[model samples]
Target: MSKALTSFLGENLADLKDKGLYNIIDPVEGPNGPIIKIGGRELINLSSNNYLGLATDSRLKEVGKQAIDQYGVGAGAVRTINGTMDVHLKLEETIATFKGTEAAIAYQSGFNCNMAAISAVMDKHDAILSDELNHASIIDGCRLSKAKIIRFNHSDMEDLRKKAKEAKESGLYNKLMVITDGVFSMDGDIAKLPEIVEIAEEFDLITYVDDAHGSGVLGKGAGTVKHFGLSDKVDFQIGTLSKAIGVVGGYVAGKSDLIDWLKVRSRPFLFSTALTPADVVACTRAIELLMESTELHDRLWENGNYLKAGLKALGFDIGVSETPITPCIIGDEKLTQTFSQRLNEEGVYAKSIVFPTVPKGTGRVRNMPTAAHTKDMLDQAISIYEKVGKELGILA
Candidate 1:
């Protein structure tokens, strides 16, 4: 490697480590359920995005194994080519029905879906009004589109309305669109979609919502757009099969024309290999399960509320999260890292989030309470948290 590249990497890595911002990953020894094994130690796992615990469900696993037996290990080609299998079409149809959209198209992953969908629709001649707290994929997608990106304050409806009106009245762009995450991941706050839709209608701006964290946790498992009753108004509803669905891939659900256009213009769909047969089949089955019953969904919320109440009662700064995603705010970076380390050592695996994942001073240990977590597990986790918080002087 060149000396310049070596120096750059060494300097940046050292800087991150010195500032307590570098992340250390732990490999899970078994299934990433409510309990996980790291380095042969069993811990109450609060770090996974497996909200419904379907990642280890026997039903999903059985179907996936059957699919692999039937369709081999991979799709073997891109969607526009020979990769679009019958199961792929079935998953897309399931997504469309689940999202209440006329049509939908699946992609390799959520990040790729954003990269493909955003750039395929918007261009240098257009403008995109994005929420300030949207996921990094949305940011990269907006950049890839070469559109003028105007960021509004995080969930500040007045700010969004003002920006939308200005962008619309200016007439500098041919098309205008607004995009946001249905639920902000870090803070776990629900987006102001109802007001956003009202403003979009007034300004005639296209609406896009990426409900990666909201699906299977909100809107009765349909997602944030549906939760707000803006299913008919929002132009693009993007979701991940990886998160709540307990599978791997993503999709954009919308009108038939938009799906058709994306099928032709979206580079990822045209160039990248399609999802595996097993993953596609499992994803379709997961959606079917969510549509058929809310048992898992209700349990998820119950655990979430119980955990949040326990933490808040213990004097931890549980932020204003509206969903199952919970964050215990620790203001100092090093202190936050120490808090998480203590939790891990005491048999919990909630990880720390610091800059640049979140702001510098507002570090946190983000907890994800899933449907599979029994009250006994949560109680033990809370006891461990109480002990750690007291030791760390984070609680009185």
Candidate 2:
């Protein structure tokens, strides 16, 4: 490699390590359920996004195996080419039904969906009003669109309204779009979508919501838009089949025209290989399960509440999370990392999240309590937290 490239990598790597910003990944030895094995050690997992625990469900596994037997493993081509199979159509149809939209289009992944959808519709002549704390995919998508991105304060409705009005009234752009995450991943706060939709209507702006973390956990398993009764108002409803659906891929549910446009115009849909047959079938079954029953959804909230109550009672700074996601806030990056490491050492596996994933001085060990986590597991996790917190001087 060139000396210039080597020098740049060396300096950045050392800087991250010295500052405790570098992440160390541990491979899981088994299924990503409430309990997981890492390096042959069993630990209560509070770090996975398998909110419903369907990733290892027998029913899903059966269908996936059957699909592989029938359709083979791969889709073999891009959607616009020969890759759009009957199973792919069924998945999209299921997504549209679950999301309460006229139509839907699937992509290779949630991140790719944003990259495809935003740039396909908006361009340099457009302006996008985005939440300052939206996922990185949204940020990159807006950049790819070459649109003028105006960031409003995180979950601050007044700031969003002010920015929306200014952008709409300025007449500098031909189209105005407002985008935000239905649930902020780090803090677990729900977006002010009701107010955002109100503002969007007043300004004739296109509304886009990426409910990657909210689907299957809210709206009786439909999603955040339907939870707020604004499914008809939002122009784009983006979601992932991975997080709550317990599979892989992403999609956009909207009017038939938008879906049609994406099928042809979205670069990812046109250029990238379609989702694997097994993934598509498993995702479809997962959505069906969510729509059929709220057993998993209710259980997820129960476990979440149980865990939150336990942590809050122990005098830890659990942030303002409205969903099942729980974040134990630790102010210093090194201390936060140490807290997480200690937790793992003691049989809990909640990982530390620090800058630049979150703001500096606001590092946290984010916990995701899933339906599969029983009260016993949560109680044990709480006990471990107390031990770690006291040892780390984070609790009284």
Off by over 4 Å in 2: none
lDDT of 2 by residue, 300-370 (tens): 99999999999999998889999999999998999999999999999999999999999999999999999
User: Which residue pairs overlap in candidate 1's backbone?
Assistant: none
- Model 2 TM: 0.99
**lDDT tens digits, residue span 1-396, model 1:** 999999999999999999999999899998999999999999999999999999998999999999999999999999888999999999999999999999999998999989999999999999999999899999999999999999999999999999988998898999999999999999999999989889999998989999999999899999998888888999999999999899899999999999999999999999999999999999999999999999999999999999999999999998899998999999999999999999999999999999999998999999999999999999999999999999999999
* Each model's Cα RMSD: 0.7, 0.7
